[model samples]
Target chain A: MNARNCLEVLRKIKDVAFATVDEVGKPQVRIIDVMLVEGERLYFCTSRGKDFYQQLERDGNVAVTALTPEFQMVRLNGRARRLANQKEWIDRIFEENPSMNDVYPGESRYVLEPFVIDCGNVEFFDLGVTPISRESFPVGGGEVSEKGFVISDACIGCGKCLRGCPQQCIEEGTPFRIMQEHCLHCGRCFEECPVQAILRR
Target chain B: MNARNCLEVLRKIKDVAFATVDEVGKPQVRIIDVMLVEGERLYFCTSRGKDFYQQLERDGNVAVTALTPEFQMVRLNGRARRLANQKEWIDRIFEENPSMNDVYPGESRYVLEPFVIDCGNVEFFDLGVTPISRESFPVGGGEVSEKGFVISDACIGCGKCLRGCPQQCIEEGTPFRIMQEHCLHCGRCFEECPVQAILRR
Candidate 1:
């Protein structure tokens, strides 16, 4: 529903896929813990001695995704920064997550660094719903990315996009309208457009 | 330990994170169903009109990851091809996965096409273990990528890398051996090496 709520859902899921690009431009992903979620900010930690850490340190850009048992999915893509107060943040993370102590006992926990993701886009998609609802928004003053397709004003109202849509989310209007919340963003409509009125943004 | 077994584990998990790069080179991920797994191959379906389908059509590159309840994770990064026998594959898929019928009933199922990943790298990582564990291999005669860091034989045996390793999987040997199975590929050892004996491939 909201960025904070979506982050909370991710934190609840705890173990989610954290994806980053390797040095060779190959996508690398691993299951990571979402240690904490505070307001619009989310926190996580990885051992500084791990490849996951190196990738994060070098790239900073990250995409995290988790799906709940209820079929609700939350995706967050943005940049994460290693916290300045390493020890303080790591200690706080450990205190909140006691299970981590078993992995890194005592002072050795410092080997792990904490990172924060406070700005980015958050998309919530629910497959449990009939129409398959979706909502995406930017948090922390981040710019919203123009993803999927946008029908331009050049529309002749041919209704080709409506017919090609899998979800039947398009409706008749002056230039026809796309119900984005229920749209699949499949680009089928974009491809089926006769006059190139549907543009990818 | 093998690609087939790892893919079976993913199939057991069913709902896993499927990662792909978008048109602009940003990571996009979602919870995708592993509809079928036969031999060393894996299969899944997406609506022809979806961005996910488009991404796969343009670029066959994909990374799929799933973690079991026991903390065992399977990662498969490979290229998927659209099958020529779409209808036959879809019907077989539906027979194996009946629930898909609910999502796309009757003739609407034709909108969904099947893709298979038969060749690529598969890595099995188990976090439930005490020291953690990992094994990676190529499947379907695919070339194994040189991922992570490898320590060369220019060993001074300074023990810095061993001390710097978070998993303590390094040992005293001719080259100060790193147990690849337990190595985090974190680059800490590479950074700690004074002679730059460690190399990343």
Candidate 2:
């Protein structure tokens, strides 16, 4: 699917596991309530006084994974940029999420800061569907280049890269082409290329 | 309330969001199937060719979070050590998980490797419960030292720590003690301590 489909899956799974790196460089994960989805950007609020807030501040890089009821999994990896003006969005967040008032009641809501994952990589995998389909796409806007090995025209059809590919996604042609979707991007084919024709995109 | 309870929750929620660090220290998370649980140790399997396997092999540290249907969230952070001998566990994993046969049928299952999260920290939180109860404990074997600030005997009962605690878990006493269960571990008390009475436990 596309980024829009990924965002739809994320919205369906409102409660997601947000992963961040702590000071010690260890992976720290916790459940987070997704406040709202505005186009490609996903907004979430957290109290400034919590360790979760500190981790996000220290490292904007974050990953969020959510599994839908139908066993569809959507993982979004991106930098969490804090909104420049928190006051502008806090009211809208409370309006959409009325229950949040109980958590941060009245004027105390100011303690919560809103952050957005504007653009990054998004992967959608559906296990419930037959043959198990999975696709990765960029959210918001970015180069649409897939991160995998691509064989150049210099190839002599050696078939070396095909044999070395773990997923065997290489198809025979004048210059063997690597299937962008099925590729694992493990760099096996690039290493096995004798003519140095394999280029990472 | 305890490690056992946390493990119970993990078992019930078989699919969990497993987080690991990439080469650049960016957090990466994906939906992983929890193969089985042996006592306090949680076992999971992944193919050696996948980036997930490579990341775990490079860095044993990982964090897993899963949310139950009842709105209970369980987060487990620990080192994922590969089982010394894969032959002993691979077959068992396949046998236990019948659907895995479709993904890796016949001899293809050998590509999968099993790993275990032996001992680590586990936090149980239930938003469905009134007052939002939460507790952290060590799984496997270790001291149940809370990660947050602990009030030392040097506390002058100044009421400063109580005021600084975001959760308001500190109670009045000769030496104010932080209620470990409700602490967010934000280090606010440690920073606000005048006499350095709050030490991280």
Model number with the top DockQ: 1
TM-score of chain A of each: 0.94, 0.74
Q: Top model by TM-score, which number?
A: 1
* Local accuracy of candidate 2 as per-residue lDDT tens digits, A89-157: 898999988987655555656667899998788987676755455688888774343555689998989
Predicted complex 1: CAPRI docking category:
acceptable
Question: After superposition on all CA atoms, what RMSD does each candidate show versus the true structure?
Answer: 2.9, 4.1
Clashing pairs in 1: A50-B186, A51-B186, A186-B49, A186-B50, A186-B51
DockQ of each candidate's interface versus the true one? 0.46, 0.43
* Deviation (Å) of A129 in candidate 1: 1.6
Name the regions of candidate 2 deviating beyond 4 angstroms: A141-179, A182-201, B142-145, B149-170, B173-177, B184-201
